[model samples]
Target: MIELDGVSFWYRGRPDPVFADVSLSIGEGELVLFAGRTGAGKSTLLGTVNGLVPHFTGGHLEGAVSVAGQRTDEHPPREFAHLVGVVGQDPLAGFVTDTVEEELAYGMEQLGLAPQVMRRRVEETLDLLGIAELRRRPLRTLSGGQQQRVAIGSVLTTHPKVLVLDEPTSALDPTAAEDVLATLARLVHDLGTTVLMAEHRMERVVPFVDRVVHVPGDGGVVDGAPAAVLRTMPIAPPIVQLGKLAGWDPLPLSVRDARRLAGPLRADLPAPAQPEAHAGAEVLTASGVVVTYGQTVAVRAVDLRLRAGEVLAMMGRNGSGKSSLLWAVQGSGPRRSGRVRVAGVDPKELPAAEARAVVGLVPQTASDLLYLETVGAECAAADAESAADPGRCRALLDRIAPGIAAGKHPRDLSEGQRLALVLAIQLTAAPRVMLLDEPTRGLDYTAKAALSGVLRDLARDGHAIVVATHDVEFVATTADRAIVMAEGEIVTDGPAREVLGSSPAFATQVAKILGEPWTTVAEVAAAVDASAGRVR
Candidate 1:
């Protein structure tokens, strides 16, 4: 239902096009995945479908684009609203109403649908995306994952023939991510909707897609069946990598397939690497922490202690008080009752500036921290705020994520790039205690690896690190300790390997393949190498 013929696009004043000579087509009822690293033009390609590329983004468009028998170059997005429904990566930017129910109705109201019809469609969408409980909640009050599902429901309510989503499951927990993907699959099967999505978490959708379209960041796009395209793709999920390691005839793209081919390899593997135990002096402590919002207790009597050189991961479902606990411990959010000290000083009792020096937090909503127009301006402001040497923030940004255009608006950046910018800005302060909330939401595998390295470096330098996240694989690789929370309380706390390696719901793909305490591809590789050395 969507077709692009020799489409080449470039922004004003840029020499190289983001992508060139990209000819592709998507048939009705097909779910297509756009796979690529961050800032590799995946989002740019999705924009072309709804005429947001040359129309809203102010770019040069070459060749013809047609969607649902409508020419995109000739018609604007509003005219094709019924034919195409587009949801960007950031949901808050597109919201026009205060409450969840109103936001869902706003899109249909714009289409001039009957009030009764809009109400029915709104209810149906609320149930479809699993946001029925959030119908009355304020848009600002919902967690990031809740907002993501709401954003998706807002578009799905329109019930357009074609649905274009950018990282639909990036903010969702694993269960929620699976539900959203299953919802999309149902749309493709029952409603005959054409679904096109861009996602970095390949493992979630690779098994459910009808086809794969890879944008390799070199002005070329490759489209084929999942197995055909994934065999040689540089980036892939752990299941695919395991398939390659075992020399399977066809690369297994899912866990079930990989399991059938993994018996021999798993039998020959060495014992999993044991993680280091950190019992350094306590650098940060939270006692009797109680956070509340009116009648709701967001965090209930939680006590946490962080030692220098320790990497702690706060694990939980969305709205399970992970973010609330992180913010309270950092002395920013509502802490009705708590004693939080960083380096022997009570951060909550200090000035905001001084508190920031003692505890730096990269909030889940990373973009809100950035107000400046461009990356350069944000970097400069961070340096000035921290009283650091000029260009320190900019230098740190490059070290974290190279090739981010300094002149580009922070909002205009990809979700991953924007997160990196905020992280780099926070790190410039060099606080004794560092906290990151959902830092891997938009980062690719390589960017995540780089972040893991950075976090490890900080821990080794005697900085206390705590991360609140839903990404289990990331937790397995980066954190030394894991703490699981539910209903504003900690349910489990232990070594990262023990916590992640034992939980079936939260274990990494590698751990699933080996049925052991393994967590990372590198660890598995080390074990495999050791076994091979013994055999030799």
Candidate 2:
């Protein structure tokens, strides 16, 4: 379905080529995953598939590239539209209509499909994407995940033979991301549509991928079966790590396979530890919180109480009111209907200085808060916001990411590094209640470990921490409690392990395999050792 021979590309004015001598091929009905760090040419490589390389993003392109039996350079973008459907990282940048139904139909209408055909295609796609309820909703009103699903559905309606999605789930919550990936899997299995997607979140998509194209930053690419290529990469999912360590051949990708492999080893697993009882002290509490748009309610009659020395993880699908709930607590969302007490102060009613002093929020888009020239300077400026000591901020940054550049522009740093800067600033203030929204969105394993340590330190120091995130592994490793919300209401609240462990459909496959429900490899190994009468 696609072919690339010795393809090398470089953006204009850049010192080095993002990819050089990269060759790959994807056969019919192949679901290939392209993965790498941010700005490692993941998106640039996908652009080559649908004639966006030399066409839309004008750059030096050398090599023979063919798609759907036609040479890519010879065909215009419109010509390849029927052969390739491209969905970008940002869904709002691609939207053309006001409502979900219209957005899905717009592409088909442009393709000269009959009105009846377009309507049928739109309805089918909406249902296929599990977004039928959003058909009548405004595009702007939908959450990031919902907008992304709509973006894919719009492209899918064109009846393209191949689909290209670049970081489609980057903005989605865990459950919503799973739904989108599941939908893609069904398309590949049932409709025979070939898929080529580039994403940073490999854990959710690795199981379904037939092949993986490992893009190296130094202008090289490794293409092979996922099991073979992933073994040689700098990063691999937890299940793959377990497979490598346990000496399993052809490392299992799915949770069921991992479970089968590790089930017999269950007796060697340690028993679940009993949670320490809470003293019923409220560190952060909210009541009658309400956020609404023109007429639609986003968060309605919400109430929550978080205790000191506790890590609370909020989980839900997109548009399930997770972020809105945190925003209300942070005193930044729409008109409020009730009281939000953080560290015994009503944030919504308190003055700006007093409110921020009580509750510090690390926003989802960390970049929006960063304006300084360097990582060190950014942290220093934030530390200066409340006359926070310089040594404290430096220590926090060093603890989170050692040997990080203090001179390079914050804009030039990786997504994970920028997030660390934001976190470091939040820690300097030492608020009694810390609010982190999607804190682990772009973290690597090492950075995630560093973040876990920081959050754990805060919790141990008796600071109430409420983290709204989709990173299940982070929640498993750090959070003490789990809060599930849906349709503007809290659905469940309980201990983290008890709540997440119950979900056979959603918990980490590696945990299921180890029979320990441990979120990190270190914990898994610890459990195995404990079973062998060893102590850490």
Candidate 3:
């Protein structure tokens, strides 16, 4: 259904092409995943399918690309709208309507479908994506994950033959992500729709996809069965890593497969050690925090305390008050009534600059913090604003996400790279307290590890950090404490291993296969290695 013949693409003023001679094909009813490191041209490849590459992005194209027998060069993106439905990384930027129902119906209306057809598709999509309760909610009022579902529904209503999604499940919680992926799987199996997706969270996708396409940064693309391609791919899920660690032939791609081969390995490993407790002094405190939007209460009188050297993860279903609570505590977002104190001063009473000095935030949409012409300029601005050393921000950027060109535009960077740039900017401020909402949205495992190390170092340096995210694996590796929120209130709060292990929905793959305390592949690998050493 999709074919790329000798395609090579490059931007103006760049000597090297993003990709070269990438010949590939996707059969109908097949679900293909694009796997690669951050900024390795995964999104750029997805854009070529819908003619957004050379047509709208102003890049040079060397070869032909076609979808469903229609050449992308022959027809404009609008002309292929009915044949291809594309969802970019940032869903909010693509929205054109105010309410959920209207956004879902907008695409069909543009196709000039009958009112009855539009209505039927709208209702079907709402139910399929499990967003029926949010049909009347304003687009701006909905959470990031809710907005993602609406964005996908808008495209799915068109009933395109080929669906191209970039990081489709990045913003969704575990349950919601499964629902969306299962719906897509149904489309492929029952309705014969072709899905081409690029996602950083491979654990959720590896089991669902029919094939894997790896876009290594060296302008080469490798396509094959998921197990074969992932066998050597550095970017992989914990299950795949665990399989490799155990020397299991034909590396397992899912938890069920991994668990089947884990019985013997489980017997050789000891129980994971309990994490040490945090003894640092309290750095931030919040009391009676409440955030409301009109009649809807987003956060309900939440009380919390943060120690100086703690990495706290706030997790829950989408729109369960994570982002609202973070904003309230940071003294920047809507807080109908609340008191937030940092360093014995209320951040809400201070000026914006003063507030940032006390509490810095990297929001869900990291690109919102960047507006400069080039990466170097943004880093420079951050250093100046924070009154730090001239090269402090750039140095931090290099440490977290290396090889980002200084001359490149922030908008042109991949979603993960853009997030890293914003993280570097926020860290430059050296605030006493830091809050990040979905920091790992577009980051691959390697990038996430770098970020985890950075967060750990910050905690060791006596900085208080709170991260609101749906990526449970990330929580297992980075957060020292975990808090689960539901309907605007904290329901569970305890050690990271205890909370994530006890909750089936939020547990990591390693924990799910090997049970409590074994929440990460690294932990299991270390335990096995130590056992071997003792025997030797």
Estimate, for each residue in 1-536, the C-alpha lDDT of model 1 and write its tens digit. Answer: 99999999998888999899899988999999999877888999999998999899997999889997899989878898998888778888888999999999998998999999999998898888878888999998888888888999988988999999998887788888888899999999999999999988888899899899999888889999999998878888877777777788788877888788888888878787576688799998889999998888889999998999999999887888998998888877889987988889887778999998899999877998989899999999999999999998888788767899989999878888999999999999888899999898778877788888888988999998999888888888899999999889999999988898788778888888777767777887888788889889
Look at candidate 3 and tell me the lDDT of residue 45: 91
On residues 123-232, what C-alpha lDDT tens digit does candidate 3 reach at each position? Answer: 99999999999999999999999999999999999999999999999999999999999999999999999999999999999999999999998998999999999998
* Candidate 2 lDDT by residue in tens digits, 426-535: 88888888998877655655567788998888888888898887777778888889988888889888988777777764476556666445655656666666766764
Worst 10 residues of 2 by lDDT: 514-523
The pairs that clash in candidate 1 are: none
> Best-fitting candidate, measured by TM-score?
3
lDDT, candidate 3, at 390: 99
Better of 2 and 3 by TM-score: 3
Candidate 3 matches the true fold with a TM-score of: 0.99
TM-score of each predicted structure versus truth? 0.96, 0.87, 0.99
lDDT of 1: 0.88
TM-score, model 1 to reference: 0.96
lDDT of each: 0.88, 0.80, 0.93
Q: What is the full ranking by lDDT, best candidate first?
A: 3, 1, 2
